[model samples]
Target: EAGVAQSPRYKIIEKRQSVAFWCNPISGHATLYWYQQILGQGPKLLIQFQNNGVVDDSQLPKDRFSAERLKGVDSTLKIQPAKLEDSAVYLCASSKGWGQIPGGSGNTIYFGEGSWLTVV
Candidate 1:
């Protein structure tokens, strides 16, 4: 019934410092995704997880970003040694998994307001 949740609606930190963001997807959702959106641009998929296993992380900046989903529910994304380029909003979204149930391209994702991060 409840929608996705994200914490620290806004965060400001110096570059190279570590920061973590948390997300709680909608209940009953079988798929979760983390996205990074810069000002004015479309959201970029950082990672996607189906249950407890990752389905995609091709766009994730592995050198500084890491994420995990345990119990196939809540998820967390951490940025270690943050970079100036990392200044952007972190968005968490959820949808039905195609493996468990069929989904169409028309199936849209719900997004949180996002956790805005600023690097100084």
Candidate 2:
């Protein structure tokens, strides 16, 4: 079986510039997520998608960050007019179910190599 997350191992962008990241989730997985991890801080959820529908995006910077899941398969995350604070690793993750939910019995989530970005 193939791994849960794949491709787009890294990326770097200048401040105020735009950049995008892509991910291909594992087969049969129903939940996908994008997270941002800055130096010295834990990963923060940027967005969460169930199939092709958005489940969460409250933590995302609406003016600069955006994401979409296509046909319940692949996903893309983009940052426009990125800020210096956006310098970090963009991680793509997936799981069979959302364990974050109460008593959901979700499986262990898997993360990709992550796209690294630097606002310069």
Candidate 3:
């Protein structure tokens, strides 16, 4: 039972450059999500994927940020023409279902060691 996996644990780029992050969710998980966390704020959901289709992305910045889950498995998130505000940790998380948490009735989201991004 492995947790989610992410790469390029840290990244730094000048504003206007492009960056991408990758994630591979745990096996048997049915839902995946991408979140953005600025230093002083809690993580904000950027995108949600149920299987290979997008469940929600209303908060995602369409002009520069994009994400996809392939074949209901691996996922990727990209940011182009990066802005200084985009400096944050990109977190990848997954869950089994609504009642899958241990000793709890709610889903337990498992998060990856976030991909840290710094825009200069």
Instruction: Residues 1-120, candidate 2: write the lDDT tens digits.
Output: 676564456666678899888888888889999999998999999899999999999999999899988799989998898999898988899988765667565478888888888888
Candidate 2: residue 84 lDDT (0-100): 91
Per-residue error for 83 in candidate 1, Å, reads 0.6
Query: How many steric overlaps are in each model, in order?
Result: 0, 0, 0
Model 3 error, position 23 (Å) = 0.3
- Clash pairs, candidate 2, are none
Instruction: Please provide TM-scores, in order, for all candidate models, with all chains considered together.
Output: 0.92, 0.89, 0.92
Better candidate number, 1 or 2, judged by lDDT: 1
Local distance difference test, each candidate: 0.90, 0.86, 0.93
Evaluation by TM-score, superior candidate among 2 and 3: 3
Model 3 alpha-carbon drift over 4 Å, by segment: 98-104
lDDT of 1 by residue, 46-105 (tens): 999988899999999899999999889999999999899999999999886644334546
TM-score of the candidate numbered 3? 0.92
> Over all chains combined, what TM-score does candidate 1 have?
0.92
lDDT for model 2, on a 0 to 1 scale? 0.86
